[model samples]
Target: MALRIRNHIPGLTAALTILSLAAVFAAVLGVIPQSSLPRAPEPLIELIPHINAIISTIAVMTILLGVRFIRHGSVRRHRAMMLTSVGLFIMFLILYLYKVILKGPAEFLGPDVIYQYIYMPTLAVHILLAIVCIPLLYYVALIALSRPIEAIYESRHKIVGRVAASLWLISFVLGNVVYVMLYVVY
Candidate 1:
């Protein structure tokens, strides 16, 4: 059954994306009871934001390297880099969800004008772009994995990949900015 589903790349990608999004939404909404979740030590909870920020920074660099490799026609290297980026992103998400579940959302401590006009809008856009990138990244990844390199060029991979990469990069950058604003500046 797993093998059959694996052969059906589109279906598998869709399933994975749906499941990932559902998990993220559930975490954000605190749908899971706090009593059911294990508590992280205060020290570990305190370290989560810094760790996630570093993961985001590494993901951005990995993505940039993946783009460079693909542009230079290094398909294997590009694939490795992209997979690394995805793994790093997953790590970031897990840590973030854990922190949010344990500590709840961070309160922005900046002034009203900055919070309302600058931070809020930037955070909103970052979240929106991250949401938009999920299915797109999955689709492109499925295409690359299920088909031959040559076949990917014939599909919508390039177009979708470009859009996904751009959005993912911007989202990560904006996330780092949000982290700084919440943790450092404010």
Candidate 2:
């Protein structure tokens, strides 16, 4: 059973990456009608950003811990931390999509120059990195799950994991910044 799952990792990763990207695109494009979905109470809707920011912060810590565990040669701990980070990310995504579907994207209320030059660019980079990170993350995760620790060391897992971790960390930080800009700053 493990061998079968291991053999299908690449295909599973690809399919998941595609589906994830498609879901994000659909949400961003507002292809899913907000009116059709059940709306959260106003209080819950208002709280989503704060919850997502907290989730992102936790994910950052988890990723950092995952890296530290790997550095200390604790493969099991590293795997656990990384998996926790992934789970947190999924939770963040679901909450984010639910909020967006219910409330739509928050408009920037800052000055035009700041919005155009700083906020928009930061958001764009954050989004691009996030989109790229999804597949890299899935690939690394699949590799780690499918192979023995020793076998993973012999594979591209290290290289890909490093890239994925870096991008994911940055994305989470930037996401927090975005939240602040949307909900706190402006």
| Alpha-carbon RMSD, each predicted model | 1.8, 1.3
* lDDT by residue (tens digit), candidate 2, 1-186: 657767887788889999999888888789888887888789999898899999999999999999999999999999999999999999999999888877778899999998999899989999999999998999898888777788888878899899999999999999999888888889
TM-score of 2: 0.95
What TM-score number comes out for model 1? 0.93
The clash count of every prediction, one per candidate, is 0, 0
* Superposed Cα deviation of residue 152, candidate 1 (Å): 1.8
- The Cα error of candidate 1 at residue 128, in Å, is 0.2
Q: Once superposed on the true structure, which residue ranges of model 2 sit more than 4 Å away at CA?
A: none
Clashing pairs in 1: none
Q: What are the per-residue Cα lDDT tens digits for candidate 1 across 61-166?
A: 9999999999999999999999999999999998998887767789999899999999999999999999999999998888877776777888888999999999
Q: What is the TM-score of each predicted model, taking all chains together?
A: 0.93, 0.95
Give the candidate number with the greatest TM-score.
2
